[model samples]
Target: MNSIGNIKPFLQKVIRSGVGRWRFFAATLGLLVALVIILLSLQLYLNFNQLLHGKANESETAEFLVISKEVTAENQSKKNESYFLPEEIALLGKQPFADRVGEISSTNFIVTISSFSNAFPFYTDAYFESVPDEFIDIKTEDWSWKQGQVNIPVIIPSFFLELYNTGMAMSQENLPRLSLEALQAIPLRVNIKHSGGTAEFVAHVAGTTDRLNSVLVPEAFMQYANKAYGYQESKPPTRLVLKTLDAADPALQSFLVANSYTTNSDKTKLNKARIIVNWIAGVVGIIGLIMLLFGMLVFTLFIQLTIAASRMDIVLLQTLGASPRQLSGYLMGMFMPVYGAMVMIALLVLSVLQYGIHQLLLQKQLLVSPWLSVYTLAAAALWLLLIWFVNKRTITNYLKAG
Candidate 1:
């Protein structure tokens, strides 16, 4: 109880003296720290995200080729007539490094979601959640990114609805079931008349990549459409897609050459480029870190100067029998308000930066990970601790010098 009474006077004296004349400098130091933290956080996020996407794309490679000519038996006799096919090669990629054997198929078309109109609606039947404007798509393209989802969309039969006991029974076992909530919120509506008397298919949502207003269907639907729509000749694919299991630099190159197939070295080049880019980014991160450290050092020096200017008063306390423990606690306590302000300002600044970046990505329909929030907060706290320790050392040195 007596110790508590003695500690109260030291705390009061520190608080009263610490907030003396340099209020503006303390505020400016804090603001600069906040700004530096924000910038570092944003740059780290951008670079990290870029690396993730680039690495993902790099793992799966697809070979694109255009057929220029075809040889035939009749051409040996006189000059056989040559014709072109409409199908394109699509290879679903598998293991990239050790086992490269993959499945190959022909796709009628690549359904890339290019852009969307003003009203983008949600799907009720989809188990996977959708974020507005995110680069998520349901594609017939054979790639790792396009797998795992049911791409072949068919009409939600009345029978499917009946299975759920919604009283719209048709045939429970034969039809595909979807939620009525999703059906009502369908994103696209268009009549696709088939070529050979097949039923016209319609969709609730449209693909965004193509300016074409229709929702994309699978190869079966396209074939059905061609027969009904009177497409005369079927287009043959130019080349077969090759998948390799060995992703080693030398092995990949050798495999392509041995097969007499030409491939672009772009993926290899990009990986190398990232090494340099990441190094540069790391250097910039370090520089920002140094600036933050320098700012804290300047603030600590100012605090030291303040204490030195009041050295005579400290000496008077020592003469009055104030213990060394009391003097140390008083000086450390003075910094509590400054450290608290710095931490709060850093958090506010980082939050605003994150919000702005998230909104920008949302408008552009890009993927933004929420994990960035956790990373930024962790980094800020780490820097704050470093600054606190440095300030402690500065106070000790100042007292010794006085």
Candidate 2:
């Protein structure tokens, strides 16, 4: 070990004397550029994912979309054509983009809501819709109901309040604007009219949701009321609430268009942006991989050139009792540090860019980590290992041949 240690510096000096400075510098620069580009592509992908799927960016309403058949002139008069058949719902559920599919049940009976307080007097004919409890964004204890319940809980769309405040309240002299808290405090008189008679139930706003744009009621209450007061037989669902993994998936948009289904455009507007980003990232990654191959090839040529130039010196050293393993180890020790340094420099540059991007995106209300992603770090380590393997193999083979 001591003899080998003593010979390392001499072997390193002999090996490096034959290396062309210009070629080594160019090879190092190319390798650094390749690593940076590869890491940059990976970081871009992760940052986009963070913006879309991070906990800080996640919305309870983002995963749910209320979809319905498009009301075209041809299908408007045909009630059956507007409804989703059981097979259609099953097929939608089986789709890769849809995590789960739920039917949006609507009341079959006449319904009306009026303010109980004369001071805030307003009356309107309304309809009630219900979806499964899991799909509802608003969670409240009052959302459940049983038979003979005197009071019914209701959930309204947040935009409904906005529309009333901006449109109706501005137009009417007697109507006053209501805040969400005030709206929840007001009690409503719900009148369920059937062919037999009208039944009254006191209803109160339990919550408001940005997800579903409908007057929502407990599914249990909707089922019971539709049975007890329904003038017509229950029909298939005309609307569906879908739970999806990605609201902006392009395949989801394609499927909707193919089946004449329509959903909220605002929720899916990012589909094009996502596709564009993916294409850009893919192109960058491919370019980086090509450059990396060229870089590795150049590095291998540099090594081969140095070994060929030092062939006479290496033969003399081996004849003077130095082992091929010792020379190979010394050559590796010289080159591996440079490779490690290049990787570190690439990571540092990426971290700075990521932090800058994180701050920039924060201004636009997008959230991403300032540090590098685990996948990026893993990729760096993997590439470093590959470089080491390639360098080691080249040194061992050249030393044996010499």
Candidate 3:
């Protein structure tokens, strides 16, 4: 108890080191705060960025191919045109390049569509197709159709609309060039002629996809719609949607060439903005790490300066029977409050910033977690431990050298 009582004087002296040398204290505090903010903020950004990108699947090697047999004069003369049999799909599954194979759910059933407005007077036979949900690049939440759902959601090729705008609509006085958004809003009445009766309902454009060049419906809806309205076929699909792990996989091209199967001309379109965001995060992270390292150096220097200023007192204390262990502990305690304050303040500020950013994302219809992720919290703890370890080591080493 008497030893503890005697140690208070040394503790007071160490704490008083920051009183006159306010510059060091303030600089250390500010630099550490900057370090923590930059480090944590950039880390948080990266975590959320990855989560968001994955949620959208904006670009993580999802390549879809609309593969159909190469039309040939000899094959065209035969009764059996071409179709992807179950065995062919199994063969594709065995290939090293293809990740998945989905039969393109296309209607052998007949379909005729007409505009609800007689002013448009548009009527034509349109083929409906649906690739698996994995193969479509469009958002799927708005792309479904049920018995009572608002309208049958359909995805059509972008070029099909471009053709109508350039060739069909330009020649006709009644038709207007439709944008994707406008086309999605407008409804088309589909009439399915079956068994001397026609069932009519409205179809809405869900979205357009660059992956496939044909009209698309949800696979579930295709089964229902066809069963209700068209003749059943025993034959397999002539068109298939191939899901490949890598767009640039050499085996994919070799197989396609070998089988004489063709796909859409567009290969892959990675989101340039996502790529730019990732690069920016990497650069910011590097800068933050440098600043953090500099902050640690400044803090270490602060400890050495304090020990130098109190060199005379330390010598007198040791001469009077105080040990280096007591001095190290006292110095570490002096810096402890600073570390604590920095952590609390940094976390508070980071929480507010993350909340604001998350709310902004919410407003944009992109949902992400508002709280700091486990990765950020774990990183913060590791950083704090590093600071504590370095500060303690500086005090112990300085005492030993003295």
Candidate 4:
């Protein structure tokens, strides 16, 4: 440390006399800009990945899609075409995009739900649908049923409550607006009518879901009721619920269109937007890489120029017993601090930008971390090492030639 400290000033004077200060500064500025662009592009790519695939951005039910046959004019009158055949279900399950496919089972018996209280007097014929318990978003202990259980739990669509509150209650003189809590508190009489007779069960809203647009019941209850009350043979499902990692995959959309199937458009609407953003990110990253290569080349050329101009001085110093290793070490020590400072400045700028982006995305209900991703940090370190290697090689090669 003492030797390095004593020799540093003399080496600085010799190198400074040889290299133009303005040229060195220009090369450094270019390197800094290139580094910043590379880091920014990496950070942006990571941010988009978090928004698209991060756990914080995933809803419990977002990966599930309820698919059904498209109701076209030609197929509207054909009852058989409306239901998916056994071969069709098997083929759909074999699709690469579908992790698993479960049929949406409809009630085989007629169902009627009526308000139990006189204050909210209402009676309407209703349909019940059931899917596997894992697919249901509402997690509750009450979402279970067995034989002889008088109380039944049901999950309704969130829009049903919203429509009643906004449209129905506003127009009706006596009907009061019901919140989710209030709706869950009220009991309704569920009547199962079949060829045998009528059976009544007390039912209450266990929860509401925004994922599925239908009234839901426990799979156990639906299977039992369908077996006991259904007068005809069981029919194939008209709809299917599919589990997938990416609902916005274009291949999934193309398959659906080719097969004349349809699903909730809201779930797959991000397809185009995601594709466009990915393309833009890719292009930006390529541009940054090109800039980084150019910056590295400029730094190499600058080091070569400095060594060439100071060849006589370097040879005299060697004759005076300054080792080649010492000279190389001094050159490295001189430039490494500046390179480190550039990296720090780039990271600082990215951190601030990332924090601002996180806040902005949070307002729109999208999730992203305020900190830089590990991949981005690793990339920065890798680039720094690459620059070091290039600079070291250039310095050693030029000094040997001198």
- Best model number under TM-score: 2
* TM-score, predicted candidate 2 vs. hidden true structure: 0.89
**TM-score for all models, in order of appearance:** 0.44, 0.89, 0.54, 0.77
- Tens-digit per-residue lDDT, 47-121, candidate 3: 556554455365555667778887888788653667887888789878986788888877756789888887778
RMSD per model, one decimal: 16.5, 2.8, 9.6, 4.5
> Per-residue CA lDDT of candidate 1, range 171-209, in tens?
454433445555434444233333433232234432232
Winner of 1 and 2 under TM-score: 2
lDDT of 4 by residue, 331-376 (tens): 7787778888888888888889899999999999888998988888
Model 3, residue 20: C-alpha shift (Å): 3.7
What's model 3's TM-score?
Answer: 0.54
Model 2, stretches more than 4 Å misplaced? 1-4, 16-18, 55-62, 115-122, 315-324
Off by over 4 Å in 1: 1-6, 9-27, 30-43, 50-280, 370-372, 400-402
Worst 10 residues of 2 by lDDT: 53-62
Ranking, TM-score, top scorer first: 2, 4, 3, 1
Query: Which RMSD does model 3 reach against the true structure?
Result: 9.6
